[model samples]
Target: MGSHEAKPKVLILGKVDFAHDAWNALTQICDVLNPASTTREDFVKECQSGKFDGVVAAYRTFHSFGITGLIDQELVGAFPPSLRYLASCGAGYDQIDIDACSARNPPLLVSNVPTAVDDATADVNMFLILGALRNFNAGMHSLREGKWRGRPALGHDPQGKTLGILGMGGIGRNLKKKAEAFGMKVIYHNRRQLSEELSGGAQYVTFDELLSTSDVLSLNLPLNNNTRHIIGKPEFAKMKDGVVVVNTARGAVMDEAALVDALDSGKVFSAGLDVFEEEPKIHPGLIGNQNVLLVPHMGTWTIETLIAMEEWAMENVKLAITTGKLKSPVPEQVDLQ
Candidate 1:
């Protein structure tokens, strides 16, 4: 490149907590811009003021929702004509509106960190499964409140029990190995069945069979239009009595209210949830219930995983700026690539 040629501009929509080396390396190649606005409204106004007119690609973090809300139609429309790519620093890109991005005149290709999060997320999923099955939440609470065990109900063992997984993606496949170590049989249902090799000897069952037979059910799918509220009242009725439910996926994927009702009625023996319908604000029923194990969306809270995610997202930004591509483009925008 010649000194006369201007560096391509890239935008950072959130703070880079780690991966400073990667970010600094990116800055050496592309001119990086950070928004001064602290609120979504101000961010919009800043964009409208042409502060980011020349930004060609953007790297966003999930926490950046505070600065700029969902990357929806209105926000996408406010972006400069030069903006063409979005790199999301998380496995789930539910915060972004892929449709709106793709609808732009020269579509905004979006990428997300996928494999980088698999192990960390799957570890959390296994933790939830064990906690829920063992009914550890009640005992933990009891101990914290100065009571020893507090006469908690008997818990079930994972050994010889069937574990039904919904959406057998990377995390789900990783989870199967962990679950199998505990002597649990694994069954899964996905939009499309995986080959035997990818399935890892776990039986591929129909959706109905999965709901009906499993002693424990794990939700591992992404949150999208078709998947929102995928498990609700009717679906709960299909499960075996005394079944345990676990969700490490997005909250909206399972109906929280319906889950409360099921727990109250003893249809579900226990539940393990890492995500909620409205984060940081949980249903009173779940909070009051001793049978539920809850974690505040800390599936990938480890430093190593965070750094990997940040670096993966930066790689997307780097690829977008230098090669006009993304390292791991979101499934919806694969056609655009």
Candidate 2:
């Protein structure tokens, strides 16, 4: 058989449920190379030794490659750089080094599953907001412990309460509609103002006003150089006392240390966190606290979202192979960092 007749080999790293759909989609078009679960070391060793023309990767694996410095010599350096693309299954390409790949041949395509993630994240944000305001987790725990005899009073109504949003992206705008449904007066701050339609009924406010006046503050901003530790000591100190904070955004956006301090001093009433600065490794200070609730970065873990992400990623990889293009290219508006 001619070299051109041979199917190009594709590699996928890590686990994605319903992966059969993704696997079939690729193998139907190209020769597929995949192992069920691969550790960082195995991943590096395999990518280094294997021959792959393209790779469809999980964002988590990219982070592993990033931290372990395996992306360079392994995936990126594999096969004299005739590789077609490195498509990330999730929205945040922060886990990958896009700029480095941009300089090489057989251009890498940085794509993401924005639609699925946005919906899942929006739902989680609202869940956190409602849960914190009503003390759902705490109350449930107290009830289960049979300590409900002298439990605290019911929470203040969300209706007419000020809802502050730190960013006005897709998830933020989605939360705005849900908050309004609960009769909240929404205010938001973003690097750039949102259009009237996307802004919903929320008012645009200065960061200071958002901090000092919001009854419940929801973070939807990304994690980056400027946004890292954005909700630190000074910002938390300026917030209204006992204000509830909900972070479904990246964990670094809210300073874990500062949040712990705020909760300790009663500056903030409570916090609902679905993500952390160092994920899978929680902050020791906040773990044992009764007032704080933690979820293991599961804002986008719903089955529906997971399936959607896998399908989108698989489609992109297939498209890149067939048409020399990507379906879900990362937009310039998004901070690639």
- Candidate models: Cα lDDT each: 0.95, 0.73
Q: Encode model 2's per-residue lDDT on 117-205: one tens digit a residue.
A: 88788888888888788767777767788887336435667898999999888788888888888899999999888888778757999
lDDT of 1 by residue, 62-178 (tens): 999999999999999999999999999999989899999999999989999988888999999999999999999999999999998997789999999999999999999999999
Error of 1 at 64 (Å): 0.6
Candidate 1 residue runs with Cα over 4 Å from true position: none
Which pairs clash in the backbone of model 2?
none
lDDT of 1 at 42: 97
Q: What would the TM-score be for candidate 2 when compared with the true structure?
A: 0.86
TM-score of each candidate structure, all chains considered together: 0.98, 0.86
State the lDDT at 82 in candidate 2: 53
